[model samples]
Target: MKIVQISDTHLTAHGGRTQENFERVVDHVNNHLRPDLVVHSGDIVIIHPDDAADRAHARTLMAEFTAPVLVVPGNHDIGEPGAAPWAGIGVTDERVAAFESVWGTGHWRHDAGGWTVLGLNSELFGSGLGREAEQWAWIENTVADLPATARVIVFLHKPIWQVADEPTDHNLDIGESRARLLDLLGTVSLAAVGSGHLHCYRQTRRGETLEVWAPATAFVAGDGDTFAGPLHQLGIVEYDCADGTVRAGYRSVPGLDDVSATGVPEVIAAITALTDSPVG
Candidate 1:
């Protein structure tokens, strides 16, 4: 199956150049790449997590695509688990409901192209919410019932690992749920884990699974200390899976300014500070 992955569009209700950039991306996907499926890793909207207008606008934009699109929730769309609120915004039942009311569900499972593709809400990883347990149970049951030969691929907003083996307290990683999730995956024929939260594009292989980090179509993170991979670029990741092999590639959006050159040091600083803050 041909799949195109785009993340962190960060669209706002008022609309701006970023929205235009997203339009260009949809056009490119429809006209040039023409993938079989489009998956958005997360962060479909910007700033507030419960803005109905922003959510509506984002939904409208996503509808422009010709291919089927599946999405998981990012911290921007639904607040991070155990983290302090950003400007009084945090994940709540209402926020979760609002997200689901528009985007269907935060988790999904599909059997296609000789693979079982699963998407989960990373915000619930360590949230301590009732839904978290429910999601975990669902994942366990879903994976447990799959055949031993089934090829599996998982998608989420935050990654399970950032550096090699060291674990950080950052909310962007899966935190306390990492061990359990990894153990669960150990039982399956895992193919790839695709995610987007770092606002950069990176591909790493951990044993047989491909770890893909799709770049944000909106803007790349500017902080150098926290983000070690390529930054300040806007793009998408394309993956082709057939039989049992997966091939992936990155395509940068043309005519877009990198975050560093956009002269938004204060915006970048705010994001970096918010993400770096300790979980409350």
Candidate 2:
């Protein structure tokens, strides 16, 4: 099975050059790559959490793809848990509902290509919401019920850890919940884990699980300072899965190398700075 992973499109209702960049990506995937499936890791829209128009526009753009697409929520699409509200827009039931209204459920399971692919809502990992508990139960049951020999792959919006054990507040990775999720995942026939939020490409192996991070179509985040080497490059990840193993590669889209510096920093700062209270 061929899977194309794209993330962090950050489309706005008005549409701009970023959207144009994404259009090129879609055209490339359709014309050249033509993968079996497309997985959008998250942040489908720019920061307009309360605007239904933003979600609608994003949905319209995603419809252009030929292959079936699956998505999980990002901080921008449904706001982050414990994140300060931008104009009273944080991760609320209403925001999640709005996202689902356009994109279907924030989490789900699909069986394809001889692998059971699970998509989780990374924003809800420690949100303390009722939905969070419900999702946890669902995940536990889903994994528990899978056959022992079944191949499994998981996708979410944030990386579980930057370093193996140490924790950092730089991104919305699972902090307190990491151990439990890792334990749960450890019991499965895990092939790989894929995510997108850092706006860079990274691939690592922890024991048997392959950790793959897909870069944003909208922009790249860090330069060499934040993430070394080609990891900081703007690109998407392509994975070929067969039997129980997965092989992955990064594909850079032309004309997007400088777009992040030119178009995204200010908005990123504004969204990152918003919080109801300071988080330690």
Candidate 3:
């Protein structure tokens, strides 16, 4: 499937430089990439607890997505800061409610072109709030429904594993629920895992699955810091389940230029390499 992953848009009704850039990114996705399916990892808006106008604008921006956008909630959108003490609480629930009011289930699973797509809510899992059990149950049932020959692709807002020691509390470590998820995934010939909360693109080998950390569409976060301006990027990942091949590439928005000048090509190469390697 030609799947494109974009995240952390940080949109707003009050137009700003970021919103303009987001529009450009949306146009590029619609006009250029024309992906079969689009997934936004989370943080579709700049802030949580938005007013009616803000929510309406967000819905407008999301509507620009030409492909079906399977969305999840981010810390900023959902209001759950896993490590940041000052970050507000109950934001995850409210953000998810808003997302559902506009988009629908912040977490779900479906089948497309012989591949099983699973979308999970990481903010809820990290915040210890909202529909985690229900989502988990749904995931179990959905995976069970897939045929044995189908490839499984898992998408979540927060990554289950980190590429390196670049520690940030935003992503779940190899913890209990994460481990359980991995264990369940192990039963299947998992294709790849995609997540976007960290901003930087990262990849790690876990058993037979390749966990890919997708870069954000709005702003990039450095390996470990929040305040550092990481850069602006929009990314895409294409999966060929018939041959178990995956290809990833992305570009900077507004300008809609590829990031080959930076390290993005190398990231894409790494992701594709995993798809070629025998499942170990």
Query: lDDT of all predictions, in order shown?
Result: 0.81, 0.80, 0.63
Clashing pairs in 1: none
Better of 2 and 3 by TM-score: 2
Tell me the TM-score of model 1.
0.89
The true-versus-predicted C-alpha distance at residue 157 of model 3, in Å, is 0.9
Winning model by lDDT? 1
TM-scores of all predicted structures = 0.89, 0.89, 0.78
Candidate 1 segments whose C-alpha is farther than 4 A from its true place: 83-88, 163-170, 224-226, 260-280
Model 1 per-residue lDDT at 86:
40
Q: Encode model 3's per-residue lDDT on 12-87: one tens digit a residue.
A: 6665544665678788879977888888877676544444465578778878888987877665555553545223
Error of 2 at 233 (Å): 2.1
RMSD of each: 3.7, 3.5, 10.3
Q: Which residue pairs in candidate 2 collide?
A: 84-275, 84-276
Q: What clash count goes with each model? A: 0, 2, 2
Query: How would you order the candidates by lDDT, starting with the best?
Result: 1, 2, 3
